[model samples]
Target: MRGGFCSGGLLLLLLIAPAGAAGTERADRLAFEVPPGMAPAAVAGDETFQGGFTCRSDAGENSAGTTACRSWISPVLPLFVFRLAWHVDSVTAERVVTGIWIGRDGASEPLQEMSGLELRMAVPIENAGFELIDMDFDGHLDMRIVAGGTAGPNVLYRNWLWSVDEERFVDSAALDEIVSPEFDPETREIVSRWRSSAAEGGVDVYAWNDGVPVIVHREVDRFDGPARCIRTFYDRIDEELRETGTGSCG
Candidate 1:
């Protein structure tokens, strides 16, 4: 999901902007550790870390995005924490969270860190955050790193699926856009809801097909003139879909 949808798609901003401002909040910036033992290995390929840690995304990315309030503990990797910064420049040099770090544990030394990073967006400073969850249901943990804003052509997406066999984090190509993606175990599917346009957008449910996420169902809503409409689509599934919606903006 990280590479497909989150990679600079021309999406429309929703009426209600996502909370957490445009950039990382200075007050909530978490301190990183490079203890006596755990030294950060410079990630290769990831140009964002060329000069240590950079917020620069792809070349043509929008530089006016914000990184707001998103730092938190990994849902599965309780030992680590992460946060987003719209612009890496929005914070002081010490507080800028350029990459994942060994968090608040009192471990006298560093635990582990990625050896290299390969950012795809214009700059990590645009708008981005991280979500740690088990996208592969391996009981370990998976990570989705998003750069750029929530929408438009400046968003960035990256996923690291835990490989139990190799005991390492590897790039995931079977995702949509990890912009806070939702998963359902019962159906074994991943779902996403986003603003596609000023008056249109929809919900998508994807299932793993040949290791990649395939859209299995979709429910789209559109507002034109003085009217509002909705449409639904089902993919290669054999189940009755019952949808129920509530409320409306005044």
Candidate 2:
């Protein structure tokens, strides 16, 4: 989900408003999923989330090693869907996907396809994969792709919000590595934690305002020694940073 793996699979719905539009149109959708695949039937996982599609796939797995792939489609403005068929090599873990044209009713064509390489998937379909969600309690859904660290500690991801005014997905700034990013529906906050060290870390609570994620609360805990440490609290809502206690055993 982060970038380059299996080459496909994720869903996102967007509602954009064009110039001089009365209010807003219906929400368009882009669905991607790794459908069930078999070993000997085909060269790639050429499956679709939508029923009855004329999609084409030129992806090959004739090279050395095993290959994995997934199917994906994105919604276009007027009346069309963009589909991609991808594959990956088993040994090298190289991945590739081809773009195919799809119609409204799920009919697709392989006209002037496009391809790329760089994918790695050894196990079965991951349950904790990418997803399309309305992070800010908005009606429109946004795209979220998760990328884990192979060796490093930082986790990276690509987030694109639905721009109703622009009629497309607006890419958000890259998010740095954090412990947990949990969103509370009742509080309407995204709870995140950043660890400075083994015993030192901070928690950042943020809220989404008009599609913008902003910090509203922060708590930093550091250990000066074993039983002598301090926990600093920061109320970002009022821009207040205070040390309520000192010389605490935590």
Top TM-score hit: 2
Q: Which stretches of candidate 1 lie over 4 Å from their true place?
A: 1-87, 90-128, 150-156, 176-180, 237-250
lDDT of 2 by residue, 51-130 (tens): 11222222223532211122222222222343433344456454322222223334433222222422232323232223
Residue pairs that clash (backbone atoms under 3 angstroms), model 2 = 2-146, 10-32, 17-164, 54-108, 66-90, 95-118, 95-119
> Which tens-of-lDDT digit does each residue in 1-250 have in candidate 1?
1112221100111111345662233222333443443323323432111111222221114333223222222223324332233232433321122344322344423333442343334332233444555575434446566533465422335777766566445677656354445766445667676666766666667777666776666565566556654444434445444443332322
TM-score of each model, in listed order = 0.48, 0.49
What is the Cα-based lDDT of residue 152 in candidate 2? 25
Return model 1's CA RMSD, one decimal: 14.5
Let me know the TM-score candidate 1 reaches against the reference structure: 0.48
